[model samples]
Target chain A: MAVTAQTTKLDARKLRADFPIFEQTFHGKPLAFLDSAASSQKPRQMLDAMREFYETSYANVHRGVYQLAERATAALEGSREKVRELLNAPAAREVIFVRNATEGLNLVAYAWGLNNLGPGDIVLVTELEHHSNWVPWQYMAKKTGAEFRMLPLDEHGELDLGALDEAADGGNVKVVATGLVSNSLGTINPVEKLVAWAHERGAIFVCDAAQAAPHMTVDVQALGCDFLAISGHKMCGPSGIGAVWGRAELLERMEPFLLGGHMIRSVRFEGTTWGELPHKFEAGTAPMAEAVGFAAAIDYLHGIGFDAISAHEHELVSYALDRLAEVPGLTTYGPPADRRAGIVSFNFDDIHPHDVAQILDLEGVAIRAGHHCCQPLMQKLGVAATNRASFYLYTLPEEIDQLVDGLHKVKKVFA
Target chain B: MSDGLDSLYREIILDHYKNPRGHGVIESADAEAEGQNPLCGDEVSIYVAFGEDGETIDEVKFSGRGCAISQAATSMLTEMVQGRTATEVATLDKDELLEEIGIPLTPVRLKCAMLGLTTLKVALHKAKGTPLPEGIAGFDELDLK
Candidate 1:
């Protein structure tokens, strides 16, 4: 879908009306939700689609010869096609449904890393990765006795690409795993370049696109990464559903992470053979309803257009940076507005982040405050925790105004 | 501001947070234990020096970083536990601490308020080999090890 400048300028106020959550008030004030990085509030279209599917065509898929079963199977498979189009993958078979991005990353670390990596091999990850991205590889390295190296972040919180290149020089690097965007810092790394560098070293690249897929467009073929993982809940879909898109050849070669009823071609006493590309990864009964909801979310985002969403978020984040800078002693993290997504993490003076979050909560402004599942990154930043205010397509400028005003109140309370 | 927020962040709580009591460690401490709220990354360390009797706490102090509720509660706990027997500190319950804070905390924030007390109990446990009194918020979950 071609998005013009006119489409890029979304009427977020009008869009907010479509989300039922906005209609409710907190403490007799409009809810200014700034925690989209944690999980986005769903739109009515997605809710209605899931409801319609369950109410009308609920059945076990790929088993019964009945019409309901056929419809259910079609819906499930059709969601895969939607995911393929969303990520611009080569085929639907490349899209495997998992629980969430954590599960998807774990699948790769178990199914692929166990089979491929060994003592002499090295798995390089970045300090910018979320715990979900970091812990799995760390566990894998420990299990396989492979050396695990972390690519450090520069002072600007961007990934040190020079350092990554130096580490990859050894050619012992078998896997290069990192995030497309830093969830805590909001720093958008040079993923395309990293992918090419990994390819040159004959190493497989894995992009944790959980944060990137929601805020910007992701084309797997263009990225040329071996695998990419995405979460549905962060992108306005259900929580228990996500997708892992891998190169078909690599996926076919890897062993199944989880084995059970549906992921088998045939079961016998002698031995059992695995099913096809996507189904080989998806074991047992799948999250059929959540996948349907995810497809509807994709349609909702497409209706808004990613180009438009990106532009809107860019505007919001730029505005937020300017406003947050005006708050005294507010030290923001990550690169400048141009290099980041819609996330702004900061700490106000010596006031603890939890206090800032609580004071903001009093004013009906919601934000996340903690280590944000990136304790190692928190240690790197020289802080225990930070308050994060993240935006989405529906976020309005007035909410940021409320955030600044709330921070002022926090300063007053603590002062 | 809402009354709920005011009650939660009372002036006394802010005062304790700003000018904390026993803010430094006891250098020649007999026993020391650290507690962390894994949810928000709030940490508290309790250091105790037992008296000649080995039951009375001669000196008690805490040093850590956390939210206002945690810091203030820790400061208050230091004041309450000083000169008390390790057994008394060990038996101190969550209600006594909550009453001292004089605020109604949500289930989640209760962990923050009790961080100092929990760490103290762990320290007392280490010093006197006394078990932590049951019903302290997050006592079981606190990884003092």
Candidate 2:
């Protein structure tokens, strides 16, 4: 095999310096965190942003007439604008902050789904969705007597569009929800095509962009989806903060998911009126510091630029695929490297994924193993679980090298 | 090999994992129960046939798919429980099983290590027509610490 040095655009070494967690070692080995799909490590800039906000500008948002409250409110809303720019959303009012992507997706299912769906209506999703995207719609369908259908995957782990026609039959398909990327298989799904297909059928499309928004360029308008969800922690941001972007018309028509202090206009004995667009959705005190940290994470990504990040990750994943092929009895799932994103899910021989992951930990090569919250997909793939090594902007080729080396070690131990 | 990996995947553990003993189901078993770890989709089913006296464990078997720690630990449990009465086996704890495996396991892996004992305890209690033995009966009850 011709092993060529792949030139990459992102300065990973420089970027790695910005993340303090990378400075540590695990089990006397350098920490090669390959679990970015679970959560990315925060950069110092993002951490500092949260710290600064808590120290100087900490106050409850959308309340209090004092200047401190106004400043706090502005900072929180400023993060919303940053998210708007990141997603290329039409208006800031369309972005609703929630606890995380799970909450965001659940908000859509509860607020929009409960109101619109009923008996004979079909809620269509794909088998490639994470639990966050799959479970909410399933629960909604059960509650509303709506028929829940999943679009099956073809031989290549791609969405079987032919099956979509049959699944969405009777012209009763009301909502189509799917992830833009498969978190387990790392297949970059054809969300744009799916959006178009759903729109033609007079059905609304909801996208789970938890994987895509962080790794690639995501434009809500370009994708033409009615609703989209993203998690802040998956990007270089803090946890406990995520957003769901919906079209203004759709958001306006839907009811508030959680009714509390901030989401109301005026509470009376008779009844309470709801607040404006996005604010109506974000109930109770928001994750102020987390929101600011998330925005800072976005700024950090933007500073490096998405193009370079994609290119760097492309090189790393491709290199990883090549190196992983050298391991005997290893079988990778999903499409080719060119077609997929940074995730690589595979199994070595009949070795259980848990065993493989445990051994890899000794080498300080962190990866995710198990069903990856996609048990249905695992069943479809005819495996109980898989081992996944996902890359990100700061992931170095040497880390992939270390991962390959660890796999060799796993072989030795099992041997 | 690193000490951590070596201790966890000791030769005896891997031996059982590679060539698991009592790995087939008994036909029309007197009592049986299934155990599953929902977190990783690991499942184990234990089948037992009581002795003529209906007190001693006459035959015990397990059929499942999981990591080495789980399968091997269960295999070890099968060997340890042979000929022991239901009440004697009922007293078996996770420490006994862990001692049999001869390794210290992290809290997360401890669940895998204890799946065998959990399943055996559940199967015995179910067969005896008694309520489940108190403490650490379910996979969720395993001391993750």
Give the candidate number with the greatest DockQ. Answer: 2
Instruction: Tell me the DockQ of each model, to 2 decimals.
Output: 0.74, 0.76
lDDT of 2 by residue, A1-415 (tens): 1112233477989899999998899999999999999999999999999999999999998888999999999999999999999998999999999888899999999999999999989999898889899999999999999999999999888999888889977759999999998899889999999999899888999999999888888999899999999999999999999999999999999999998878998999999999998889988999999999999999888877787777877788899889999899999999888888899999999999899999999999999989999988999989889999999998988899898899998999888
Least well predicted 10-residue stretch by lDDT in candidate 2 chain A: A1-10
Query: Which docking class does model 2 fall in?
Result: medium
lDDT of 2 by residue, B67-108 (tens): 999999999888999999888887876677888899888887
Error (Å) of candidate 2 at residue A110 is: 1.1
For TM-score, the strongest prediction is: 1
Each candidate structure's TM-score, on Cα atoms with residue i matched to residue i, is 0.96, 0.95
Report per-candidate TM-score of chain A alone. Answer: 0.98, 0.97
Residue A296 displacement (Å), model 1: 0.2
Give every prediction's interface RMSD. Answer: 1.1, 0.8
Angstrom error at residue A333, model 1: 1.0
For model 2, the superposed segments whose C-alpha errors exceed 4 Å read: A1-8, B133-145
True contacts kept of each: 0.77, 0.80
What lDDT does candidate 1 reach at residue A227?
93
